[model samples]
Target: MKTYQEKRHFDKTPEPPWRDDQDKGQHRFVVQKHQAAHLHYDFRLEIGGVLQSWAVPKGPPLKPGVRRLAIKVEDHPVDYIDFAGEIPQGEYGAGSVEIWDKGEFDLKRESTDIVEFSLRGKKLSGSYALIHTADKNWLFIRRKEV
Candidate 1:
């Protein structure tokens, strides 16, 4: 099976969703940016056909029980990997975008309540999981090292 980046060629086409060359497939990746808030990172993973985004606040936690507040955003095109320029002034996410961490992930366990995956990223090296809460929001947590 091809990875998300490999399945979708962002180089040949750099259009957003709804384009003929666009891909609406699910994907998961991270983007490092020098934003207005002291240069934090953005970790986004695709789920339910939407890109579940999180601002990390301090990047991925190194230990378990570390819950990060993740803010869900609009579903971005799978071709977003090709985006590496400025978001332009007056635009949302107005900052420099760079591929921070990206690769195929294995869904070790998944359900409406919990989802776990082994994340392979340049900045993050460990297994990560997201559990749904009663409020309908999800809690992003790092799995304990075995």
Candidate 2:
């Protein structure tokens, strides 16, 4: 939470602030297309009380066997899952954000190196896997449809 707050000043940015009573026991997911220093997709999974985030450089692949680089980022507030706007210039992630896809996901498995899940979104659906490739680096792979 500190990392998230430290990156952006609440006064300058429109991003939501950290909330303690935001968790509703509902698992939600969001993929935000961010146009920042570089174009990337921000994938977030609602867990615990925050949103676990990843920055996929090339966006999520739709075809099976295709892998895209996903870099882990700071945990954002749960309220950020629905955020869509322009982050002011000079802010940490100064850019325009738009919701690309959003829905719920089911966790299938989780291990130290990999996490498998099923995403049910308007643009993305079916099983997916995130394999840890290096420290803070992961490979987002679309699993074969079953």
Across residues 80-133, which tens digit of lDDT does each residue of candidate 1 receive? 545566655444455566666676566688786777888766666678887776
Q: List candidate 2 segments past 4 Å from native.
A: none
Model 1 root mean square deviation, Cα atoms:
6.9
Give Cα-based local distance difference scores for all models: 0.59, 0.92
Worst 10 residues of 1 by lDDT: 1-10
Best by lDDT: 2
Candidate 1 local Cα displacement, residue 70, angstroms: 1.4
Model 2 / residue 66 / CA error / Å: 0.9
Give per-residue CA lDDT, model 2, range 11-114, as digits (tens): 99999999888875667899999999999999988877789899999999899989999999999999999999999999989999999999999988878788
List runs of model 1 lying over 4 Å from the truth: 1-28, 34-39, 47-50, 134-137
Q: Which ten residues in a row have the lowest lDDT in candidate 2?
A: 19-28
